[model samples]
Target: MRTASPPRALVIVVVVLAALLGSAYALGRSLVDGVPEAAPSGGPLTAEQPTAPSTGPSASPDPYQQWPAEDGPYGARSTTGDARVALTFDDGPDPYYTPQALAALRAYGVTATFCLVGENAQAHPDLVRAIVADGHTLCNHSWNHDVLLGGRSRQTIQTDLLRTNQAIRAAVPDARIAYFRQPGGAWTYPVVSVSHELGMMPLHWTVDPSDWRAPGAATIAARVTAGTGPGSIVLMHDSGGNRQGTVDALYRILPDLASRFHVTALPPEL
Candidate 1:
């Protein structure tokens, strides 16, 4: 098509517009195609499934490390400089046998720690007062004998411990509870932490006589006598089933324990 050529300025303007359009297209292409890259298959941008916290017994801390050292040993008996050992009775304040246990301790001029069940303490406030009157220390043993209490949550453990402490205070308003014993010796961090916050030492026994099994008075006495030593915390039961054997064993065991070790209750503060 032979037609008159356009003006040079017009031609220049057209060329300039075409160049600008091409530059814009290039920028748009770069923006669309030049993102650094997609993250690799396992990169952080990938969606991840959440994991649940462990709730099994295996998740628990080492029994010895669960509690702070200032609070006391978690798995072993408390260390003391003196030649003193603690005689501790659990699940107590029984109307029938507690009196006998108390009498035996008194006769020997020995003091012991009584880890009382909250319900029993509530039921036998007189016995609870009697325990304190006898110069024995007090320990909270939970509302009931919950062997699995260690596996519970912090809030649940706290509630259980607080209720027991409340029950104990209800019995003896001015009682000084020095220790907390997990039922069946099933201590966990949550239980220990709760007890520490509540101003009670987590008590673990060095000697267990298996008195709760009613394994004859002689057997109980033998176990206690054999197991006791300086700084030993001997575990016995005054209630939570037939504890007559325990009461009888105490009479036989105390004379020997008193002579061998300066048997006494755990001090109020320690």
Candidate 2:
């Protein structure tokens, strides 16, 4: 005899139950695949334990890598690039104080760089010769010590610098004016470019005693001695008013500086 067919409700119920079971198995497999492995000692999963990024050496930036490019001529120089210090006197060759300053330098046997004012150099060619004779370097300090010279037109600046160099050269026919120091340390791009065109290095000082104001000898000596370090270029004035304090301070400064550093003049040639 042929078997009887199952009831329609029973067949429908079986189909619905089979579909529900299939869905549950698929969902269970998906959850298992999605879950991260447990951490050591049955701790929380790695996905649950979020951590910050490491900050090790590889993350740090190199300091010298992004160093800024020089915008003007090289102004920093030290003799032989060692523990050397340079003494520079500006606006010099004064009839009254230049001799005393020179004598002080001579007594200490220390050669120095003298940035001479063009007019002053023109007036005292003898002193200019004396500076060179003493084996010191020569620098041009502009005509009349114009602090505003850097702001003038390029042609005017050039003419002023040329005139200054001419004055310096007139003193000693073969004088090597390898450096140009802007009066008041006011440097402009045009001034720097023109100085380079004239084959002169722009000179800048590291230590400034402000002895130009004739702040007492002791104060000037203190500032000079305290500010100076290895590879330093010191600025002092031998002229531009009563510089008697500077002349006297040299006695204290030279001995102390000589004892601590290799005090020498800047190279006369660039």
Candidate 3:
């Protein structure tokens, strides 16, 4: 009798399928659950109506539904028919790269989202305001980009979310900052709970260019382009590491993405 062994390619194929399926499950669950419905007397539901949108001219849609928590803390999911999708940068509002990034975005007539780290926001409020003035979404990345999700206290996580919200509110009070992308995409039992406590929607990326690795612009663009699709949230960084590669890739991909698809900012609501 011949001994049987698993084919190497077959194993690889099986692994890829499993990973893809797992991702699909997460995406489906997140979409199906979108944003949780608020209780009758939740924090912002009854009191903070204006910032939230109503369903129709006459009907009141579920508040959570009105502002779907679909934006990957950094911004909204980029989908196929979306004429254009949101282009989001995390850990930024930096002086060096953001100005260049903004210039490119402005030149292309496109918008983006910036998931601001609290300390960075404090350090660069001008850039944050400019981001808002320039028509980009400002989201929370955390006060310190802590690994708080895995082990920190709920109070600490809440502080991270609430403080950043306040900081953004101070700079651009009109900017209805609604999303929270955890540091390293880290989450735990308290992550969503604390997020809910502070009136933010947790966000994560479906595609990450890992531009922080300083992958040359061509490679970065290639990775991102390979992943572009509907309901996809592409992750790039503007700060927390050298980001010239990210800036360069943005210059290349923005025009290409716009040419092939709708490259617009994700709306706060439908």
For each candidate, what is the lDDT?
A: 0.83, 0.86, 0.75
Write the residue-wise lDDT of candidate 1 on 1-270 in tens digits. 889989999999999999999988877876889763444555545236445568788696654464546423453234433678888889987899899999999999999999998888888999998999989999999988899998999888889888888888998898889888899877766777788888888888778888999999999999989877777778888888899898888878988977777888888886
Clashing pairs in 3: 71-75, 73-203, 78-231, 79-230, 79-231, 80-230, 83-262, 84-262, 84-263
**Model 1 CA deviation exceeding 4 Å by range:** 1-67, 70-82
Error of 3 at 115 (Å): 0.1
In candidate 1, position 125 carries an lDDT of 91
True-structure RMSD, every candidate: 12.5, 12.9, 21.1
Please give, for residues 1-270, the per-residue lDDT of candidate 2 as tens digits: 999999999999999999999988877887889964334565754877666566787777643333222323333232235579999999988999989988999999999999999999999999999989999999989988899988999999999999998998887989899988898988876777788778887788878899999899999999999998887889999998989999999999999999999999888875
Sort order, TM-score high to low: 1, 2, 3
Q: Estimate candidate 1's alpha-carbon lDDT, on a 0 to 1 scale.
A: 0.83
Q: What TM-score do all the candidates reach, one by one?
A: 0.73, 0.72, 0.68
Give me the runs in candidate 3 sitting further than 4 Å from their true place.
1-84
- When 1 and 2 are scored with TM-score, the better candidate is 1
lDDT score, candidate 3: 0.75
